[model samples]
Target: MSRKRGKSGRRAAPRRSQASTRRSPVGANAAPAGRAANRSRILLMIVGAAVLLTGAVAYRVFAGTSPATSSSATLLASTAGQAQGETVDGISCQTSEQVVYHIHAELMVFVAGESRVIPEGIGIVGCFYWLHSHTRDGIIHIESPVDRIYSLGNYFDIWKQPLSTTQVGPATGAVNAYVNGVRFSGDPRSIPLTPHAIIQLNVSSEVPAHTFTFPPGL
Candidate 1:
């Protein structure tokens, strides 16, 4: 009877050891499963971010608007049109932009109390024009080979738009011009494109002239 009991006890010990071995595999597989789930969650997050970015780009493209100066501001298109390589008001379009006399000026236009975006690539169409805009922030870039005076009229010509006391682009009203925070008495088009000059035009309503701080290395 003692021998039989001892044998039964050994058999029971092996059964417990086998059970522990089986449980060890389950514990090891649980960690791998958790790591796999974490990886899947990370992948899902990355996909969600990509979708959001794509949606934003699509919205901007289809809406025909951008994050510009004002929410209600309409972004004006390049009026360079068919006059890309042609000279307008003595402003030349060359193969490359000249920096011999490079300066920047700011132009602000408001019609019915809403701002207007002077878009980039105004004087760019397969070439670079002397008087051009590189951004929609209203900075007009005067890059020419000669250091001479250029007027707002020349830029309007390049833009293929009209500017007068009664007209600014397609909007027509009693237009007011300001330069460097001072009221301009003469033709708004005659306002010279001076270095860091702040030129503002208002139609139908007048607002106080504002100054602009040019960016460094502008």
Candidate 2:
């Protein structure tokens, strides 16, 4: 219903219907392009979520199988082998008839004629065993309620030192183990923990006479 005036004329014929407005090529393609962008954003979010989930699972697995737990298990397996009779190798003691039983034992290490001091404050972390060291004087304090033959192996395990028939810590050579001045021919780990027991290890050298005197009230 639109009209235009003409020069010197009353009115012109009604204008033909305005041609339908044409859509731009760009605008015609915009709707599908917008949809595609939304889909891409959703895909990225999904991928990110999956990656985070995988990382959490991996962390849990590594934490469960940590080195400390593995090493302790291996040492326990060795101790099980040593416990066939009443004592573990040469290490045997009656569990306390009372609530607790405690024993004192000393350890000395010799490498190439030099004394290696056993450090203090060993066996104080994570899961503690019945056998543990209380001081830097190399005094092993065996505190237990259940009777088990705790061996030098258990102490060494708690100490986290490399000890075997062929190796002792950083000193790699034939290891000679002695208990109470007597030489042991079996595996060094089999040495027993007895009250007032004096344990010594000679790595790549002659076993020296233990000069370490027990402290008073040991």
Candidate 3:
């Protein structure tokens, strides 16, 4: 009983100090309202920055285009008719044992039942033949005959890079076909073309079909 009585009065000392307490470091002297608000805003800014960075990294990983894998043009439809109108009248394809040919001479005439031509001296690789006097109208041609497997070489001054295929067979029947490092925009449709294949006259031109030449001995 005597110890209990002494403990109560000692605790009473804290009550007296509370009755006359002074300002303290974490109380009245604590950070101002403006300073506290600034701290909160800085924390929010840091969180937002982290979220934005994460989104950017995810986009790069999933949506980026690789030079070798990405194609500049779209996949053309199955046949050349899309170039003209509603029928096979506008486009045509001719195949030789060794080469595939497309002639864009005149689509209107083709629609009217006409054909385009192929030129000669075209089998040699790196040969440049100007089909039209107009450069824009000229046919950009390329060919490759394999003395060995997997040896492809192209020299088109138009494109600064050599981005095409040099395969023997048709390109797995896929659109946007490539052969011998040559890129062609057509339906996977091609000639009955094969290795060392030769044709008498095959001159392909994008000029109007009536005007395209089918020069002899292609």
**Model 1 lDDT tens row, 33-95:** 999999999999999999999999975563342223555679655464636678888778999
Worst 10 residues of 2 by lDDT: 68-77
Model 2: residues >4 Å from true position, as ranges? 1-99, 126-128
**Which 10 residues in a row give candidate 1 its minimum summed lDDT?**
62-71
Q: After superposition, how far is residue 213 of candidate 3 from its true place, in Å?
A: 45
Error of 2 at 82 (Å): 22
Measured with C-alpha atoms, the lDDT of residue 69 in candidate 3 is: 14
lDDT of every model, 2 decimals:
0.81, 0.63, 0.27
| Tens-digit per-residue lDDT, 2-74, candidate 2 | 5666897668766565455667779999999999999999999999999999999975564343222222221
TM-score of each model, paired residue for residue: 0.67, 0.52, 0.23
Model 3 ranges off by over 4 Å: 1-20, 24-37, 66-218
Ranking by lDDT: 1, 2, 3
Prediction 1 TM-score vs. true = 0.67
Candidate 3 local Cα displacement, residue 29, angstroms: 6.5
Evaluated against the true structure, the overall lDDT of model 1 is: 0.81
- Expressed as tens digits, the lDDT of each residue in 1-218 for candidate 3 is 33333555653332457536666756664568668899999999999999999989964543232111122322211222111211121112223222333222210101111121212222222322221111121232322222222111211112211223222121121113333334434322232233322211111222221122222332
Q: For each candidate, how many residue pairs have backbone atoms clashing (under 3 Å)?
A: 0, 2, 19
